[model samples]
Target: MILWFTYILVAIAALGGLLCVVLGLAGRRPSDLTVGILGLLELGLIAQVVISIIAPFAGNPPTGSLLEFWVYLVTAVLIPPAAVVWALLERSRWSTVIMGIAALAVAVMVWRMQVIWTVQGS
Candidate 1:
């Protein structure tokens, strides 16, 4: 688990969250641009999950409880798509706001995962 990659991913998630929030507050619906940004964040999250799965075998497993780490990872993996679905269901600025919330959650979760895997490394 490269710390720099994880840190960058976290930053992207945070910035993505801020973008969505700003769009929502500005009275804009979930546009193609927002969806694209969310997709990119999802890609990063999925990449992290893949990394987490392979890290154990690579001899750098998380020192914290694997169950908890897996739980957080799985939840993070679902956030973007779920938010997109929610935004699709309702075509209002608030829908984008919901996605904004999801993005924030992704940021926090990514940061937490990094702590579990790197800071607490066994």
Candidate 2:
């Protein structure tokens, strides 16, 4: 995994989590901006996936087992869209909570990716 890209994902997730907290505390519904940020996060995740795919062929196979890598990749790619869809249906502060959960999950996934890479490297 690319350290810089993982950092970018973590940064975006942190920002999203902050936004969710602000919206929840203010008793406001999740806005388009929240969803937009999620979209941006998703884009970053997709870029990570693409890079992962290319790296191996470029003679830089990822450190993790393929199964572990795929699990992280699929979850990272799916979470934002799933969160957006689920949030849209709720229309409450809970939607923000859901977004928060999604952000946290992304953060965890990035950490896991790092761990997987490190374990493989050793």
Candidate 3:
């Protein structure tokens, strides 16, 4: 994984999570801003997926367990859509909070994938 891109993704996810949580705590329901941020995050994840696929063949294969990295990537990619669906269906402050939590979770998972790629070598 590219270090800078990973950092950017982490920052975006963290900030997005914080924003949604604060909004929810202030008694606001999910808004387009929140959903849009998550949509951006999902797009980034998809890009990462493509990069991961290409990186291996371009002489930058992960040093850690490929299985573990792929599992994390797949799961991280799923979280945003799930959270957005819940928020849309519930239309409540708690749903916003849940979306925030999901974003935070994705951030951590992405970081872990980075570790697996760059630090944990066989």
lDDT scores in order: 0.86, 0.82, 0.95
TM-score of each: 0.93, 0.90, 0.98
Q: How accurate is candidate 1 locally (lDDT)?
A: 0.86
Highest TM-score against the true fold, candidate: 3
Candidate closest to the true structure, highest lDDT = 3
Residue-level lDDT of model 1, residues 2-120, one tens digit each, is 68878888888888889999999999999998888889999988888788878889998788778778889899989899999999989899998888889889989988887877777
TM-score of 2: 0.90
Candidate 2 residue pairs in backbone clash: none
Report the lDDT tens digits of candidate 3 across residue range 1-122. 88898998899899999999999999989999999989999999999999999998998989999999999999999999999999999999999999999999999999999999999968
Candidate closer to the true structure by lDDT (higher is better), 2 or 3: 3
Instruction: Please report how far candidate 2 places residue 38 from its true position, in Å.
Output: 0.5
Question: Which scores greater on TM-score, model 1 or model 2?
Answer: 1
Candidate 2: 10-residue stretch with minimal lDDT: 113-122
Off by over 4 Å in 2: none
Q: Which candidate order results from sorting by lDDT in descending order?
A: 3, 1, 2
What would the per-residue lDDT of candidate 2 be over residues 11-92, giving only the tens digit for each residue?
Answer: 8888787888678667877788888888988898888888887877877666767788779878988998898888899878
